[model samples]
Target: MASPQPLNGATPKPKPITPSEISAEFSHHDPTIARINNGSFGCCPSTIIAAQQNHQLYFLEQPDNFYFNILKPSILKTRQIIKTLINADHVEEISIVDNATTAAAIVLQHTTWSFFSTLFQPGDAAIMLHYAYGAVKKSVQAYITRAGGHVIEVHLPFPLKSNSEIIVEFRKALQMGKANGRKIRLAVIDHITSMPSVIIPVKELVQMCRDEGVGRIFIDAAHAIGNVNIDVKDIGADFYTSNLHKWFFCPPSAAFLYCKMSDELSDLHHPVVSHEYGNGLAMESAWIGTRDYSPQLVVPEAMEFVSRFEGGIEGIMRRNHKKVVEMADMLAEAWGTELGTPPDMCSSMAMVGMPACLGIKSDADALKLRTHLRVCFGVEVPIYYRAPVEGEIDPITGYARISHQVYNTVEDYYRFREAVNKLVKDGVNCTLLPLCEGYAQLLQMLLKSSLPVLCISYCSAVDV
Candidate 1:
């Protein structure tokens, strides 16, 4: 076979989207502004929007017939698309959920933590990173504490040098957990860290979890799906959940949970709604109540849309990651900050550490930076405080994570830098501005209204 050529007909370039093109795309959706915080909730393509609308229309056209005859078949079609995209053997092992958080919570709810109560006896250890999503950390901790299990929090090094360095540090943390005589029952690992965008070596970490005789390995891959080429089977995790709404361009309520097939762990229960009392398929866990499953059904269209524009999943991954690297370089130069992770360790997102202002302590400072960038300049990105923690301190001090997707442009980051510099030069007290008025209100409303559109638009833009 001849070697495949580039999909875009040339080497993929990391150029910003032109303002005219942005206007044209937003014109289709009737939105007056471009959204830069796609990492928070991705924008769907127009195709997925049409698919969703078609499904809803069908339901309204014949409510009972659509629910009874059409819905299951549509979902099965969606499963086939998901299976091909993720390279799964059986489509039955995948179940759609609202988001990654709900998927993880459902898995947690079904597990019999008491089975490992003796192994993870009181003071027996569980380990999690400081950078893990606060909600996920809290969920895991709650489960362990109820079973009288101890929690050993590990602080991952900020501004990591390479992928291997992160793997080594994670291994060391596991060793520490074992040495403390708390047989690790479960470890919550992130395929991509929420704030830093660090792509951890999940395969190696899962194998290590198995070696430690851990009962389960739960992955919170909130930012993984469309941002990377994910083969859940290759990762060898016991349980995995990821947000299609965030990365895969599916509409809101589009996400999936995967459980490795085994007779020992076959039957699982839904988190809240339990229509299926006893079933082995993954869908049995989340498809309990009567609600619109249209978002989940539209996933195939979203995937197809992405493949049509960017060639295929691999092509899209390469382009998105390249854009993230390019944006990080441009921002670092413009802001005098440094990139935290090397190219290999980074995915389609990057974190740049900013200098802290005098007397600006805690996360409030981070909020100020976020506000200044969004209200003053229209750039939306996440700003977070990296406090001093054991084994990681200095360079990790103050940082903001910038995420890049297909819809983002280089000009967005440049505008963000200009706004922050202006605020610093003026010695402006960001908080002094009336918290209740003007640009702030506009920003708040824009973000609120954009959520559904963003979710729908992601699938439409990407097609898968």
Candidate 2:
């Protein structure tokens, strides 16, 4: 979404958001709905949004100075801050991209095709888990296919019982690839999955890749930053990318890519070549043509704002993790369904199973359910449909992924629970349920109406 131009020709300094003022902090959101989908696009505080507006106004005020002189310095400063935040070795290795997908694409597209051919030949394989994001997967497949390489998809079952299971499955895939005379070239793994919302032990996975002769590893940490503690140097991944908008409280279109400073990567180029064509990774990425630099500029302010919370960013992460667990447990128990991953394996987001009978056959059907939850029931959460894996028996499932941020309350989850339960019982038609009945009643009666309106109407309606 394009940022709206500032109103009244000036940006106001709004108060910083605090934990207690969670819901009130974000006035841009639809108040009637409980926003449990922060994992998709993060909720930006009004203060940060105002700061972005100010930066925009400043850019237009002196376009020449801002673009030629001030912009580079400001961007460099933000890179240094991000370097310290993610524990990168140097700012020069970091490039500000629009999002993680773009970052991954730059790495794949900029590298000399000859080098990729040497690393991954026609029969050789590049590995990615089945749970990898669609965009990341497509980029890898396209690049690898063009280079005459095949993909080895490591299948990971949802509702997994243990983290060790992931390690075992990965090792098996590596052995299978070796047996087929397929040398594993590059492996793409997520720090936290987008759909199931499970936190993979990336540090361990990186070591396993090294031991198994996987040439390079790309850590897709899109949902990892504010949710999981990060130490990029310690993780020792060849490449890492994460979205500031998702968790670090920055506006959309702001994310950073970190490449291990190496002589080999000195020739890397930005995807969009411009006047700064051959100026190395950092410079090339900085001048990817004229666009909104506000998202990248106000990153420091977002970091400072998050640090001002109760125990700072650490406290916020802890609170969010706890809230997600609480919500996941409540909904799982209500639906008599299992969790997508174990409790300890999840961070700020968790996926709880839904009845497969929801009849969510396509993406459109899944989206309709999500919309019904939002528009009719005033509940905003992500709904996913996981098709049955080849080896599983009737294991097909639907899932509700809930995200918890500082600007969220348990009351929001309760509202979500009430709404979802009602939807399920009405056979996903959503036409039979009172739609706004429970939503309105919750406002009038709050927790007091939980038994009659929420429990009986939604929870108890499901079979034990």
Candidate 3:
């Protein structure tokens, strides 16, 4: 075990990093930044990225050959690996998609009938945690409303005290829906929440949905796949989706959607109804009009690469959980703020409350402060605004989402900590205070310049 090669000018601190975990494996990552934001859009290993590139080139070299002969097998193989990885009942239950958002759209679209009958009769309800991913939440609202249904949000306390607390809140939502005569037609649960990262008690939530007689259950496990051990069948959700690009160390925008293999899903389909409309979800998703399918193609290499570590993917996850919890707690202690989540409730990512002295009162402030951290200090952690609770009107605005991957070390967290400390000491006003100073001036100049899109894209697209 040794330290990874020093990134930028930072010296490698001795740790238990193996040769396979060296920086060369992650050469695509920016060497200048302390990229602790793996949960946002996962960073892929160079080897796996190379594998995808080769697959892309192979597709380009012979378009008809790749599409007609080569594509389905690669997709099927990736789905097969995912089926085994998540303990799905059958390979056909898994369909590879672009990301969790697309997977969500597919599920939500089919949840309602287009013409004669609907999954929701007039006032039926679709239940989801208030913490559901924003895009997924929007999709639920849009699709369910079309079916003459409505959305019911199950609001639970943040910095949740125990799994029991979540169970109680969800149960209340079910009962309230029932009492109000709004049949709980659908339930969406997060296997792991995005903003304030926590390992949701998904099994319990799924069982609760079943017992409550919810029509169909969808586990939005977008951040789950490589982040935790999943037994999809055991969870018993009708629909489940997880993103390989987010945590499985795969390239951008690859994920798996799992539907329970039964007569109930005979009409399930990929949202984009192309030439394969009448076919099953697998066939329909397989031929989505000839874009780069390289990410899904190289998933085998991504999963295989996990073997280079000591105990395989599960072992890597265990080590990552330990490291992230330790680092998050360190940030909380050093910043004089508390952790939003307890240790057991968290997985490889956790939310650490940022110091209040930074004047981050709104999400806008959080966004600018986030940019300030990137430009002035070269730190790349996601700064988030936590949701409110019953009593507190103004909850904490900013929490640093720290993620731990095999490529990351304690030194990265150290870099983030030092940057925040410097900001606090220097009185960098988050609002109008210091957007004119130092590197921020350069960031603003780039934004205002006719340099086209990079600067504005950097600010908005990179945030979440």
Q: Which ranges of candidate 1 are over 4 A from the true structure?
A: 1-34, 112-124, 357-360, 388-396, 429-439, 442-464
Best by lDDT: 3
- Per candidate, the number of residue pairs that clash is 24, 0, 0
Report the candidate with higher lDDT, 1 versus 2: 2
Q: Tens-digit lDDT track for model 3 on 254-296?
A: 9899999988677888877788878789889988886888988
lDDT tens per residue, model 1, 1-464: 97677888996533443546544543454232335567887777656778899999998999899867887787777767777767777777777677788877766664435435343367666677767887888887777677677676666777788767767777888888888465776778998988867898889888888887877788888888888888988998877778888877777868777777766456565666566656654546435667777888887677656655535656667887888788777767766778888887778778876654322345765676566456545667787676666684344466667776666666677766665566555554433433344546665565556443221211221100
**TM-score per candidate, chains pooled:** 0.83, 0.85, 0.88
User: lDDT tens digits, residues 1-464, model 2?
Assistant: 97576787676445655555664558778766688889999978888899999999988999998897888998999899889988988888889889999988887774326346464466677788888998999998888777777788888877788889899888888887777667887788899989777888888889999998887789999998888898998898899999999998999988999999887577677778898887788888888888998999998788778766767788889988988898899988877777888889889999888766565555555665675566445778888777666786555367889898877777888887777666566655422233344544553354333443332323333221
So what's the TM-score on candidate 3? 0.88
| Model 2 stretches astray by more than 4 angstroms | 1-21, 110-112, 115-120, 356-364, 389-396, 427-464
Give the lDDT ranking, best first: 3, 2, 1
Alpha carbon lDDT at 360, candidate 2: 59
TM-score of 2: 0.85
How many residue-pair clashes does candidate 1 contain?
24
Candidates 2 and 3, the one with greater lDDT = 3
